[model samples]
Target: MTHVLILGANGQIARYAIDLLLNETDAQLTLYLRNANRLSNLQSDRVSIREGDVLDLATLKEAMESQDVVYANLSGDMEGQAKNIVKNMEKTGLKRLIFINAFGIYDEIPGEFGKWNQRVIGQYLPPYRKAADIIEDSDLDYTIVRPPWLTNEDEIDYEITQKAGPFIGTVVSRKSVASLVVKMVESPGLHVRRNLGINKPNTNGDRPAFME
Candidate 1:
């Protein structure tokens, strides 16, 4: 069975991914978080929860051992945390990763949509880009997922863009993002070495439809 470590298990996207993996695949999972007690309700034989921070080398190193894949859904000083993950994974001989980054990390969004996003989240873009750079520079086989504004929806449909493409679509469902992550974990070859942008299909606007 594929062994997976989810580094930010308490995140909404990570939570959805945990449920999907448990229900749809035979993979075993270890959910690592600062406060894993928040996920006590999901405790099961196939799922193990550990309380830890990604920045703690010893704790993270122990968590990475023996895992086939590392899926990181994280925020805050992203570049630094990503640095820690890269170092630990290198130490553990783990190479596969699924990193959740935000849209505009490449400043690829265009037109009014681009301007809107900048106005909304200009402050967060730099650190996110720095984190993406760290992952890109590493030897690890990684899929960097750059998702647009996320929503809570049941729909699983999304369109994808490679890094250089003008990032399209406004808001994609968090479930769609998680679904893709689980698909990658199951297949293990879905989007290796690619930086992907995900968005709900048929969506286009200055801002997410939900905002209006």
Candidate 2:
């Protein structure tokens, strides 16, 4: 069975992805997180939990060994952690990665909404941008999924855009991002070394609501 290691396993999107992978695939999953206590509720024979910070290279190396793919859904200190992950992945000879990043990292959004996004989330974009650059430069086959503001809604219907194309909506469901991650892992050929923006397609002319 394919083995996958997930960083930031306690995150909302990561948890949902874990659930989807558990249900839909027979892969062995290793969940790496700083707080193991938060994941106490998730018990499975195919899942193994590792308590460690992503910034710690030794720990990351230990967790990454023998894993076929690594899915990083990390926040806070993401750039440094991503660099460490890349370095270790090279050392371990594991060449597949799927990164969860934010939509505004590319500065590709247009109009007033784009300006508004820059005003609000702009300060945080640089780190993710740097992280994306690191992944792009690495030898590992990588897929970066950039989602707009996240929501708790349980739906998997969303559209994706490669490169600088706009997704046309403000927010997407966390479950949808999770589903996408699982699909990416199952089929790595679909988005290797490509960055994609994802959002729920607008059904009507009404303004999209922010995901809570």
Candidate 3:
């Protein structure tokens, strides 16, 4: 059975990943969040709950132990969190990582969507970019996922760009993102050391639908 540790368990995308792992694979999960009580419905034999911050190295180190895969779905001060995860993983010799950062981190988005995203998230991308830098520099088997504006749809229709062209499409469903994460965990070497941009197939627009 695959053993996975999910950081930022409280986030919506992470929750989706947790459910997919528990329901779809013979996977044992250690769910980490700042508040364990928030995970009221996820208790099960295959799941263990841990409450702590990823920035807390001691706690993060402990969580990384015996974990075959590490999936981080976090936001805010992500550079610090990435540093913490990378440092501890190096110490523990844990290699596989699936990290979720947003689409604009690489300045890859094009057209009005790119402009809108930049105007909207100008303040958040610096640290996220730094986070990507840290992970890319590390020797870990890492896939840096840059998903477009997230939607709540359940459909898995998505497209992938491997850092080769302009990031197409405007929004991607969280379910689609979870599917990719699950795929990577179940098959460890699927996209090792690659940066992937995930988006909906035909949803490309001037901006996210919500704003237009």
Candidate 4:
């Protein structure tokens, strides 16, 4: 079975993705987080939890070994942590990475509303953008997913666009982002070495056509 390592496993999006992967896919999963207590209930035969900070290169490298893919859904000092992840992955020869980023990082958000979004949420964008830059520059095969405003709504319908492409909407459910991450892990050919933006499409109150 394919082995996948998830960083920030206790995070909301990461938790949802882990649930999806555990139930839907056959991939062996290892969850790496700063606190294992938060993930006490997630233990399973196929799931293993490791307590360690991503900023600690030794811990990250140890966790990344023999892992086919790494999904990073970390918050806080994301840029520095992401840089460390890349360095450790490179050291370990773990080439595949899927990084969760936020929209507006490219300044490609459209309309006056986009401007307001930049003013309000802009401060946090730089670190993610810097993280994306690190991944893009690395030799690793990476997929950087830039999602729009996140909601805890229980829906998994959304759309995705490539870098420099027009963003679809302003908000998306965390469920959708989680679904996309699992999908990418299951099928790496779809989005390797690309930075994509994801959002819910404007449609009727029905299941949307595509996600990622």
Best by TM-score: 1
Please provide the root mean square deviation of candidate 3 (C-alpha atoms, Å). 0.9
Q: Write the per-residue lDDT of candidate 3 for residues 107-200, one digit (tens) a residue.
A: 8888887888899986688888899999999999999999988899988888899887889999899999999999999999999999999998
> In terms of TM-score, which candidate is stronger, 2 or 3?
3
Candidate 4 overall Cα lDDT vs. reference?
A: 0.86
Estimate the TM-score of every prediction.
0.98, 0.95, 0.97, 0.93
**What is the Cα-based lDDT of residue 207 in candidate 3?**
88
* lDDT (Cα, tens digit) per residue for candidate 4, span 1-212: 88999999888999899889989999999999898999888668999999999999888889998999999998898889988998998898888899998888888777765776787789778888888888899999999998877788899999888897766677788999999999988997769999999888873221222322
Greater TM-score among 1 and 3 belongs to 1
Ranking 3 against 4 by TM-score, winner: 3
RMSD of each: 0.7, 1.9, 0.9, 4.3
TM-score-based ranking: 1, 3, 2, 4
Question: What TM-score, to 2 decimals, does candidate 4 have?
Answer: 0.93
Q: What is the lDDT of residue 197 in candidate 3?
A: 94
* The 10-residue segment with the lowest total lDDT in model 3: 120-129
Off by over 4 Å in 1: none
Where's the lowest-lDDT run of ten residues in candidate 4?
203-212
User: For residues 27-139, could you state the per-residue lDDT of candidate 2 as single tens digits?
Assistant: 89999999899998888999999999999999999999999989999999978998999999999999989999887787888776778778877998999999999888888
